[model samples]
Target: MLTNAPSVAPVPTASAPVPTDSAPVSQLAVADALMSLLRDTTTEPRPDIQLEALTLAVSADLPVL
Candidate 1:
């Protein structure tokens, strides 16, 4: 089967972007990020890293700070 479809990475949705603000202290957002950082991935989110995330979220008006 010959196909002309060149596979390419999918684009991110509107909600998804490089966080430029602090993360909201909402129960959900932090929980989701925490899960993504801690259990599911090898990357353990350091406090410093979290702080940076918080900064971005704040910048984005995420109400995290």
Candidate 2:
């Protein structure tokens, strides 16, 4: 049962603030960010309608097909 692990005790520091439910970003914001990324990397015509629909569906907790 020999081990080389150190037995150092951790020092406690000030606790970080906990985020609330409201702190989460809005669904539209997330979608917008994703869209930006896609548009930057893609040269094809932007799939604005499809992307928006997907974002809305995901945000609404609806099943995507």
Candidate of highest lDDT: 2
Writing each residue's lDDT as its tens digit, candidate 2 over 1-65 gives 34886543222222322334676444445555555556668456766898999999999999999
Model 1 scores a C-alpha lDDT of 0.52
lDDT of 1 by residue, 6-49 (tens): 64322222334334348323434444555554654566755788
TM-score of each: 0.24, 0.29
In candidate 1, list every pair of residues with a backbone clash. Answer: 20-56, 21-56, 21-57, 21-58, 21-59, 21-60, 22-54, 22-56, 22-57, 22-58
lDDT of each: 0.52, 0.57
* Stretches of candidate 2 exceeding 4 Å from the true structure: 1-22, 42-65
